[model samples]
Target: MITAKNPVHAALFLVLAFFSAGGIWMLLHAEFLAIALVMVYVGAVMVLFLFVVMMLDINLERIRQGFWSYLPIGALIGILMLAEMVVVLGSRYFGLEHVPQPAEFPAGYSNTKELGRLLYTDYVYPFELASIVLLVAMIAAVALTLRKRKSVKALDPAKQIAVKRDDRVRIVSMDAEKK
Candidate 1:
């Protein structure tokens, strides 16, 4: 995806990456997380991304021109992420000996319920904050797309509702059907 020239292809690669990560979660017995990852990121987010890429008029030439200018910042971000990952993976807690395998649950136990319990109870504030952030993003996207265009005509509901019969129609008495 890093080397993909097309933005659409890059987004598709991201979907593949999400699927792979979800598969890994499934292997680790995180069924709820795996399904959530596939459903939310792959099903919803990637479809939105694909729609955006298809609808937008992107100039490849302009993108290529700005590549060099963006490279430095991109590389800095990549390096920072790499360093963070390395630190986390190299931590003692991540070692096999330090990490214990989770005990198998009974057949009737539901991972989804447990996850929801934890999310709504212990992490309610963060969950609400994420929802607010998503709501803001959705509103911002709508606002961005609703830019004023002189060529496009729109009706005001207030004006429409305020109109009286006398304002919209003129009655003609003498000029009626002089066939």
Candidate 2:
């Protein structure tokens, strides 16, 4: 996975890495999270990514035009983020004095159950808000994609429903010929 050189290889490697992490989570007794991660990231996200890559007409040259100008700033930001993460993770910086230690784990403890308890009891409001936000984002994406083109004769249900029967079916008086 780490041997990826190009963007496509990197994406594939990332998907593989997520799957591996999910497997690790499963082994650690977080089956719910493990399955969720695999299903969401591997099944949905990776497939969506593949579709986007395959379908999109990407303008590489346009993107690369200002790459050199942006590189320094991007690299600086990345370095700062790495430093912040290191500080947060390092005991020497954010030590025992700053935060409480994790509770001792009982033998045969289920990580998934613990996570569920914490999620419902402690973080339910945040969880609900996150879901609502995601729903809104999905709706927004659908609205954005649904552009009404003047060229196409698209039917509006409201307009169709409002139409009178007389307007649709016109009765014509014609002389019947003897056959």
Candidate 3:
């Protein structure tokens, strides 16, 4: 997805990746996360992303021209990330011996219930902070895109309110003509 040349193709590939990750999460018994990944990320977010990508008037040639120049730096970052992942996954702290097994839950126990409890009780502040950040981002996006262009004709409420009856209606005396 990252390597996809076309932005739309990249978005589609990302959707595929989300679906795959959701499947992996389902396999790991994280049903809430898996469903949220598929429904929120894949269904809603990806659709909006694809719409934005398609609507954008992008110069593909210009974008591709810089790819070769930035390749080395991108490769370096990718390699570093992969190395970090390997180190974390292969470290002794995360090894089978060091990792504690999950406690056995009764059939009535719901992971979703536990997740909701943790989210609302333990991690409420961080979750609310994240929501605030998202709200600010949304407002910022709107403010940034809302430009006052001279070409666009807009009504002024003050001017409209100040108008009198004569300003809108013109009366002229004329001789009546018979047709």
Tell me, by TM-score, which candidate is best: 3
lDDT tens digits by residue: candidate 1, 36-122? 999999999999999999899998888788888889999999999999988888888775455324665676777789889999999
Return the candidate ranking by TM-score, descending: 3, 1, 2
List RMSD in Å for every model shown: 4.1, 4.9, 3.7
lDDT tens per residue, model 3, 14-91 = 999999999988766678999998999988999999999999999989888888899899999999999998888788
TM-score per candidate, in order? 0.66, 0.62, 0.71
Given candidate 1, what's the lDDT at residue 149? 85
Q: What TM-score does structure 3 among the candidates reach?
A: 0.71
lDDT of each: 0.89, 0.80, 0.89
lDDT of residue 49 for candidate 3: 95
- Colliding pairs, model 2: none
